[model samples]
Target: MSDAISAASLLMAVVAILYGAWYQEIMHAIKITVPKHDKQINFMVVHNVLVSRCLPLTIMAAIVFLVFLPDVIEILQHALSVLGEMGVKSYRKYDSVRTAFCLVVFVSFIIAMHLCRLTRALMEVRRKLK
Candidate 1:
């Protein structure tokens, strides 16, 4: 189960990086010297910035989850065990870590969905402009 979770997390990170790079390249290729209306140009810039920020953050979050969370949780569980025998205290500590892990996972999923939507929107706009 841990192996599967690790694999999935790694895959998600890679996909996020690839999508970000592809989107950036596509946006860059769309640069044409038409007399830019401020509004349209501003919209494009803002969209690009938002996508850039979100993609990297999403990727980073996934990497942290994949590489750090498991080990950290294990260490934490061990530390908590010293405080008391393996019962309520240990379970509570583990539960806290689990909750944090879940939150990170949920956020990553949301960001992934948003990135997908943003990519689609960008592609559509690029098509229309062309």
Candidate 2:
């Protein structure tokens, strides 16, 4: 019975991983296709900023903060002492917050990259339109 249960669990895990991979691939394909509205977004200043500066800095900061979350929280509390002085509260669930914050970072990066690609597509379409 134990052997059967272990095998079933392993099979379920494999199936879940396969489904996740397939879903990610489908979503990625959908993301790459440009929409009509996306062409209107002025990707001039912000796109350059995200691609050149903000993206790299954000990536590094996310890595550092995730790896040293406790230290990062302590540093932020100390550095932004004024926030505390003003009655702003720090997160008590550091680990939970960190996990959610990491997800936010990941989503932001994905969105930024998509916008960059959309901007490039818009530039191409602009020439054709004119």
Candidate 3:
């Protein structure tokens, strides 16, 4: 079960990196750089370096979330046991609890990220409107 979670997490990380690299601010950061003299090949700084940092910030947010996993697991385990007591014998299995926990955490993380992005975008749009 842990192996599956780890595999899925790894796959998600790879996909996130690929997707985020091309995503709004990161893509702009990669393409735009401080202008260097055309005649001389000089080093150029990123145009908006903060935009590039968003990827690392997002990854860090995910890592920070790992701290809560154990608590979530505990709650899920309890819920599973309770469900079993309530006559839902199918959820009583140890593996079932772990799998359900993984699914819940994965979905929660995805939702949180999307909501954050949506909020940031709305704020940006509001600022532009001002």
Q: Give the TM-scores of the predictions, in the order they appear.
A: 0.39, 0.30, 0.37
Best of the two (1, 2) by TM-score: 1
Give the range of the ten consecutive residues with the poorest summed lDDT in model 2.
Answer: 25-34
lDDT of each: 0.55, 0.43, 0.51
Each candidate's clash count = 0, 0, 0
- Best of the candidates, lDDT: 1
The regions of model 1 sitting more than 4 angstroms off are 29-104
lDDT of 3 by residue, 1-130 (tens): 5654565455556546645654565444334433433412211222233343544455554653464477567767776777767665655444664665467566547744863574365334333333
In candidate 2, how many clashes are counted? 0
- Candidate with better lDDT, 1 vs 3: 1
RMSD after Cα superposition, model 1: 9.2
Ordered from best to worst TM-score, the candidate numbers read 1, 3, 2
Q: Candidate 2, TM-score vs. the true structure?
A: 0.30
Could you give me the TM-score of model 1 versus the true structure?
Answer: 0.39
What tens digits encode model 1's per-residue C-alpha lDDT throughout 1-130? 3554465456556766765666665455344333445446645654564456544654554565555457556655666675577555555444454445455556566656666565565555544544
